[model samples]
Target: MNQVGSLIFLVALFLFSTFLNWYVFQAYKTVLSGVDSERSKQMLNLIYWIVFGGISIWVVYTFHQIFKAGEISTAHQQVLNVFLTIVVTQLVCTIFLFGEDIFRNIQAGFSLLVNGKSETSFPTRLKWLSIIAIAISMVPFTSFVYGITKGKYNFTVHREIIYFDDLPDAFDGFTITQLSDIHAGSFKNLDAVKKGVDLAIAQQSDLFVFTGDLVNHEAGEIEPMIDIFNKIKAPYGQFSIIGNHDYGDYVSWESPEAKAENFKKFIKQHERLGYKLLIDEHVVIEKDGQQITLVGVQNWGKGFQSKGDLTKAMEGVASENFKILLSHDPSHWDYEAKNEPRKIHLTLSGHTHGMQFGIETPLIKWSPVQYRYPNWAGLTAYQGRFLYVNRGFGFHAFSGRVGIWPEITVIELRKK
Candidate 1:
């Protein structure tokens, strides 16, 4: 956006945050009104402003740094996460307080109509109502804190078995372990990351594939963890495709040449990790003298990068071949892959990260990202074509995962 537009947006956000702070403060006072110790009340008020006001100032400073540098450092990202958590918690409390005020006004209006005179004083704030609001707000406050502390490294494995009538007999019972979105720049704990890599290695799948997003902004981000990731090797082969972030488009560079150099390094990093990086190409995996086609395309989503050419990737491969496609964005399936006349048997993608937060259980699976992408996470089939969207092997923008932990997917392919 233009400079003026950015300034206006920041100002508007500051004003809204200030209003929430003031409104929540009223509820705080009501909840503490019964306390007789003036000193204790004064101390509590001081702590409240120190946290809310301090975080607000930090947020403004972080934004300034981002605007100037065209990048958000890890420290700045964490500060933003903390600010978001506090704002959400305060908004929850504000809802209850606002409702109480409306009820108070209605009661006063009823009294005036009955008595033929306005009440001399407003009704006292309901201490219990405020107390309940504060108590409930803690749920989100604690959840965000836990997410930042531990949830990001909590890797979970998801297993799926898919059967295909047209599958090659030699490829039956073939197991493929898939990972996606290893935003290496966002990782802070190396040991924890290694543990996740080890878990993927232990899966012992026949083929290993990474869908995309090896790094967040630049290739340098993955340099530190190369050894850990290289440990993930499969018997058939390890293959990968590029995601939108791997192009280094999110951050500014000194020149076009510098950005191009970064892109080159990113591709090399894939080679260094022993992955056959496929840029709109196909590779044949032969087992027991029979074969299946594995086609990989560059980032191709509805709104994001549309560089992947399915036709070029599938060239020379017959339409009757049992095919598995490596695509970074699930929207590719929604927009192109699933609708192709040649019929791709399976497509793997992992761009959404399930918003890194949502509830997933046996009965209900919901995330805010589902509204934007039809196939946000897990397995979904459309007209006999299947798409498996991995939740991601790492965290990003938010710095943590809440209900949806980082994922490693093991998919077994069987002949029907």
Candidate 2:
């Protein structure tokens, strides 16, 4: 489903961005038609189209990243957006062109103060420079799209559930490493993924976990990073679960056999990486006679259908053991884990990679993802329950993280 949704998003953005580029091109042509010098106007118009065309593509890439998490209405008042964008874009271009003029004039004035007139004033060429600026404004976006095409890291959370800090007198300063939402096939190949894996190992975590999104759609994409993931050495072993991206629900398949084969290969890859893939199951990790029940379920969502069977996963677990959960989507922590019959003490998740971009500050930090999920990233404690959201190990297709760098959460579980 994740794979198909991503494709749908890409297609939608592709269409939408193409329409916007056409609009910009038309506007540029209209402006050029009225200019006194047709030849210069035509040259400037061509430049405008190229630059804005590139920008439209970059905007489309950003839209694609945001749309995959949920259904968004791109066409609602799109005509208005185009018109407004063109007007505002023109204004921006005019400001830059005029600002350059003002700066040059100021510089000339300074020279005149020292040497007088400097060199003939150069005459006013401001007539059509605004058009040139309008066209030139799109260059940055074009370069950005090219950058994304080169490579992007779409990583999931590392959902490690071991004790991190002062652990119940029985366990002490235990560290758990976690990752989530690794959209494997979304890009060409792994680049900085090894750095992420090595960073996870450097935390000296006791246990490691990967909560889901192991593949974009086809499980074979999981093969490339097996060796890198194997480097995540933990004393208690690594555990994992199926995220929405894991079930092969997105693309068409000729037969169940082919799909099963794809799924098996990914499973084998996870095994080779030394991870215990838990599907709606429980594992008991013991230390000093005290047991921590690690419950992992399939995917669950607030709006989307629940693929995870939370109840079934914890069926055989003892009531006395302290429970920790590995649920992919943050919504699971908000709705299910907190209110579960057994009542989980801590929950770990990674589906929201903070949408791979946003602003963070000492006073307050926020990502666009926060509007959807309550605890989008970082640690949240509520009603004595704890959830740690790993910002994630890699990025999505819009790869570069502005304020939120790709992260590997090293949680030191403290027993208070």
Candidate 3:
């Protein structure tokens, strides 16, 4: 947005946030009135400053960072830390306040019916209700704190065995490990990030594939982490495809030449990391006189960039050859890859990042992003074709992950 538009948006957000803080504080103060101890009053006052005052400071910091940097960069983690903390606390407090209001209205209605009076003696704020609100708010506060401190680095390995009826006999037990959306700009702790790369290295798969999104906006973002990523090795080799963010399309440039230069650097970074960058192309992997087709296309989605050409990538390959496609966005599987004339036995993707938060357990799995993209996370099949969307190897804008931890996916091929 332009400077004028950005200023208006900031002003509106500041006013709305100020009102929300006032509303929550008023609800908190109602409970303070019932306590008579001087020590208790001082403790409550301290709590108010810590919660409400912290939020106000974060608002100022966010605005300052946006103005100075022109966007939210990796340098603004401290601001985001406060933002996540206050949002969860306010939501829980608001819910309790709503319940208290409902109870108060019910009491006043009963009094009017029995005594023919419109008034009642019920306290304006019940101490018990306020205590409940504070206690409930703690749950989310603790969880988010953990998410910021540890969850982002808690890389989980997901292993799956995909069986195919048309598999090549020479490649029966071939294993492939996939990582996606490194978003190298978002990484902060190099040691912690190294541990994740080490985990992928320990797998010792025959082939490794990084689906897309090597950097957030520019190639310079991955400079520091380039050596760390170079540690990933496999016997066959590593391959990659481009994602929307790798094109540097979201950020503004001084000139079209500058943007083109940045893209050139992006390709150079991939080559330095030993990844065979594919742009709407295909490669043949041969083992003991048996070959399988590996097709890769540029970032393509229903509403986003549609640069992928399935036909061009599959030009010379025979339809009978078992094929594995690497696509960045899962939407491609639903819209194009699945319905294409030539059959793609399996596709590897990672773009959604599970929205970086959700409830994912053995019994149930859900994330808000599901509403936008139906084939969001994990393994999904359509008419004997499979699509595995890696959760992601790193995070983006939010600076941290919640229940949906970062992932390294390992898929084993079995000939049926």
> Best by TM-score, which number?
1
Lowest lDDT 10-mer window, candidate 3?
114-123
- lDDT top scorer: 1
- Candidate 3 stretches with Cα past 4 Å from truth are 2-12, 37-57, 60-70, 110-117, 120-123
Candidate 1 residue pairs that clash: none
lDDT of 1 by residue, 300-335 (tens): 988898999999999998889889999999999998
Model 3 alpha-carbon miss at residue 290, Å: 2.0
Model 3 per-residue lDDT tens digits across residues 120-227: 565477777777887888887887788888999999999999999989998999999999999998887999989999999999999999999998889899999889
How do the candidates rank by lDDT, highest first?
1, 3, 2
Name the regions of candidate 2 deviating beyond 4 angstroms: 1-38, 50-167, 187-191, 397-400
The alpha-carbon deviation from the true structure for residue 332 of candidate 2, after best TM-score superposition, in angstroms, is 1.1
Score candidate 1 by TM-score against the native: 0.94
Clashing pairs in 3: none
- The residue-by-residue lDDT of candidate 2 on 1-416, one tens digit each, is 46787787768766765664564454456456666997898789778767766656665655564455332233322332343344445444545655766776887777677676645363343435546666676543443343344323433333334433324566566677787776666434555677566666777888888888887677777677777778777898899888776777766677999989988877777788788998889998888877788898888878754889988999988665677899888898888788876768888888787876555677888877889987998887777678888776554444444456566777666655
Instruction: Output the lDDT of residue 62, model 2.
Output: 52
The TM-scores of all predictions, comma-separated, are 0.94, 0.69, 0.89
